[model samples]
Target chain A: MRASAESNGGGADDDAAQVMGDGRHARHVTLKDVAELAGVSVSTVSLVMNEKKNARIAVKTQERVNRAIRELHYRPNALAQNLVTGTSKFIGLLTDSIATTPFAGQIIHGAQDRAWKQGYVLLIVNTEGNEDIERQAIRMFLEYKVHGILYSTWYHHEITLPQSLKDMNTVLVNCYSDTENLISVVPDEFNGGRTAAKMLLEQGHRRVAFINTTVESPARTGRLAGYRRALAEQGIAEDPSLIVDAEPTQEGGRAVAEVIRASGATGVCCHNDRVAMGLYDALRNRGIMVPSDISVVGFDDQEVIAAHMLPPLSTVALPHYELGASGVDAVLAPPVHLDDHRVLIACPAVHRESISALD
Target chain B: MRASAESNGGGADDDAAQVMGDGRHARHVTLKDVAELAGVSVSTVSLVMNEKKNARIAVKTQERVNRAIRELHYRPNALAQNLVTGTSKFIGLLTDSIATTPFAGQIIHGAQDRAWKQGYVLLIVNTEGNEDIERQAIRMFLEYKVHGILYSTWYHHEITLPQSLKDMNTVLVNCYSDTENLISVVPDEFNGGRTAAKMLLEQGHRRVAFINTTVESPARTGRLAGYRRALAEQGIAEDPSLIVDAEPTQEGGRAVAEVIRASGATGVCCHNDRVAMGLYDALRNRGIMVPSDISVVGFDDQEVIAAHMLPPLSTVALPHYELGASGVDAVLAPPVHLDDHRVLIACPAVHRESISALD
Candidate 1:
């Protein structure tokens, strides 16, 4: 491995030598040198190298700058620039699981997509849901002097701040901290719940049931609040018996569905997509037809459930990509002037064929 | 930000003030000082500080060393150590999508789990499915002087690497490169296929169809190879008509089912869980019973699809978590003799109720 390493590095130097136009050795080529070689302004060379030369310089001039950069083997000194500017151009994304769940991955994509457009690199760390590991990861980020921290959680829960991170600019995604200063961005669960209820109610369904996991779960609570809000907006009285709490699994959905049938509810709103999935099986086993015997709606618009349900599930969609993008925005935003901190992103409703109009 | 910056360096000194136990102005409290204070070796202090001292020293001695290190507040100079040793404790994980898929998340979790256990930190970057971006990210990894690289692709495809990465020790996860010398740990696609076929054959199914997206996809090719091998072992002649290519989506599964029914196939295997979802819709629409009229199997065992399918889907599971963990292992493994390269991991099969006996 070491033998090949020396040869490859030597080969790179040789390749550069072949591309050199003159024997003039300046040690490291700068933007000014590239500009001089290309016969363009230094800023013009910078713009061209940064891929922002469009509309600022003629296409031919841009081409010349690029050619000069390639000929000189010019590489930007990102680390030195970061040291001088005190901004690393690196955003530290602390995710509990960046690669485990589709939600976190989508969020990272949205955040990175925006960050890259703005010429920033993401220093992502997957903590794997361990608090001690997370604390150590954050300490490393601080040592690296990252510009901001985007703390993304796998589930909705209270987050504890690392001592080293107490002073840093941070934005929490899908989680909240008791600390007063940290900003948080989460999906609009209340709106999602309200939308699910409105969709089923609009289909002329009365006596709708809300099947959820635990009231302790913030997402469940927010969705339940939205359901109540929507019912009140429609001048319908909220019934406590219609709301059943169960686990957020297939078994949970199945168990709750049985209760829904016994309660004589013709429409059901699930806390999230997974619950909706279980309802499908329970309904099927009981010879209940979705959108025929009863209408069903879910939240989160999880791709597998929404698309694959016997009747494609009508559900409220969490703007996960938007949540991540906006979380980055929150972290990068100027420090909050006041103590009150909250950033709620809108969760839009997605309509499919799961709900049928009651005759 | 500037105000905080000026005060930041001073706070450490002030924090160090509390450690002046000897009355000799604390002597700057370096690692050497900690070694002297604890009356133990410097390497022992390092192992203790980094939490690797558990196995190396007696428990009482370890506690004494830890207490001394904490009292001194001697933070290990990570950057200085990296520069001196030429080994950054950071591992670079390069992925095509940062936050879009659940598979990537599981892989990351596994990698992070292993990395944490070893006291190595992962520095992750998302490539956004663009070759140019991937090249830039890898270059950044090189510039950062990461000890190793873990390159994960969103889909199974051959990747052309940057020249700078030619000498770098890298482990390809969920993807492979044509380069002969690179070590890669990819999911065992052939085994996955064979497992799927064996499961169906064991259930007394004489004839089964393989529904895939494309003939050229590596995952499909491996699976097909496994399918044929299983059939051959069972003394069944391979049927060309049994292999059907369809889109790996819900609509695609539905379309393939239409073709499968016309061909009189009694059992079907899908390229992925998503396609299996489409099969569910098609089967339900035609009023065909699952595992009754036809038994169906899927791959990738995506949670949403497996749980919600009218009858939960039986799928050949991709060891996503193991893939990540194994990639880290390959990265951290002592360099295999300068010549040997390539590591392949096996994917385990998971059975649900999606398939049934033809008897």
Candidate 2:
């Protein structure tokens, strides 16, 4: 397709085995073979394969070419076509430990599905936070002439944009950049936290406890604000005593159970499912049953933990798939400034049996 | 490098930006530019870059070329090098659903690490079990002239070889072919099962119950045999009544807990960590404690479930990482016949708090 006339020197219908650059012997069915079989020129076959509307070819000749192609099973060379078309149909996805994280699978899945639908393929590189590997991977992406790149992370966080990626069409997924040079798709943490709080409030629990994670993150601040807002909407004053900070783990949940019990709260919102699980264990140890004694809700509906809990935990989904799909859309879409240079995907509330209506 | 004389038509020392096929404008410093800066021929620069032994260039000239390379930040174009060298330093990895599976991360990580160590980059395609995508991906791989392919599955199982892969150099990872046409690296299920049984046996538990999954698989059959073998080695007759079969999940663990308890077994080995977790819950419900009442062992040391259990699960590792690394080795190795056309990686035993020595 890229003026490869020199490649047609091999006699038509030679049926010769081609030795690939990789030293693999492959019986390549070249355009010359099909053209010779159809009694047409190589350009005619290429035009037919590319379906060029501008090229005027006789219907009978086109039919002959099609039949030859079917018989020989000629697959047009994508690399050669790419050279002429000036598009590789490739999108590079660079992730910081997405493959190793169980919940992050949906991101790749969503990105792959959207890329496939758009007639592109994703070339993924999991950097595992190794800066050297990230830089080398970027060089490889440049060599491949990838159409665009989707820089993603396993969790929502801010990252310093790699200087090398500045010249490329890059979009961040489940992560953002401090410099707003590139667009990004991240979860709406504030609303996700609000939804977790509302789940308990709608069950008629007036006194709700927000067990925030001690680690400083957008989730820590956003969810706390959302929880307070939800209480205020219900004519309940924000009580600072109801907010407790602990590690965002099962152990953290167990450690905070005594404090929660002493506060006289009817419902509690955990930072994540792991914390809720720890709370469940501690409550059982103290002979305090969930829902009946203290209705609980969690964030991050991690399927394994949340779904398999004694009573499946009600939580908020992280919108990983949506973030991935949106990142691809942003990278492929026409270059335009987005509001705030970011797209906030909603974290949906998942209702489970962890919460019960108050009498 | 292959004869790329045609590419040398451009004038040297021209700082012109090259428009890539993907329409990305990149300031690519060419070999000619480096040669011009070093006051040497382009061929000499290439010889220095490739470190050709036969080409005796002056040490002073080599230093000059190296200095120019460092100053200009010139990177050899991998695509051009691939075209001339007849070898693209790219290994294609095609997986059925590794991206979505929780435990399959190690496979990609291992393969990526090994490939990088060998100066090769991996181009992965997660087909998600889609035949059309798989076929298309293979065609793309062929067009790019990949050096080799590693066809992997998320789990250790048997699969039909894709017809198109017959001519290509492919090695199966965590999966095998019934036809035995291609070499494969799979986990030693028999040894993995044996390890699980031995963990309880070593704790002086003679009457050990094996809670196997009802689903017929290599794991079920292999583990059962291994369990019986361990008992036989201990001079204990196999007790058929002690073997219970249920689903492979947590629910499956709960369903068979009663049978395990009724058998008067002091120790039990479960199909997986999920089952072990479920058994823990069911045992607590029945006022039976783990290790104190009935020592437990699980398979598949799934960190999240196994480590987070009230008492950490003692189980066997699946060797996912080893299987993946072995697959890469097999593909890159010289074409030679392998023993039985397969490489079985060992599954190591993981000791945790779930088991206790008898007093």
How close to the true structure is residue A68 of candidate 2, measured as C-alpha lDDT? Answer: 87
Per-model DockQ against the true two-chain complex: 0.17, 0.23
Give the alpha carbon lDDT tens digit for every residue of B233-335 in model 1: 9999988888899887777888877788877777888898888878876776677878788888888878555755667888888787787888888776633
**Ten contiguous residues minimizing lDDT sum, candidate 1 chain B:** B18-27
How well is each residue in A1-359 modelled by candidate 2, as lDDT tens digits? 11222344343213221222233434455666788889999779878888887898889999999998888766656554443332466788999888778778778878887887787778778888999989988988876667778999987888988888987778888888878567788888888888988998898999999999998777888888888888888999988889999898788888999999889999999998888988887787777888788999988887567877877788898887777788777767734556777788899999988898997
Docking class of 2: incorrect
i-RMS, each model, one decimal: 9.4, 6.3
True contact recovery of candidate 1:
0.29
- Model 1 Cα shift for residue B273 (angstroms): 2.0
Report RMSD (Å) for each prediction in the order shown.
10.9, 7.5
lDDT value, candidate 1, whole model:
0.71
Which pairs of residues clash in candidate 2, taking residues 3 or more apart in a chain or in different chains?
A21-B86, A86-B21
Lowest lDDT sum, 10 consecutive residues, model 1 chain A, at A18-27
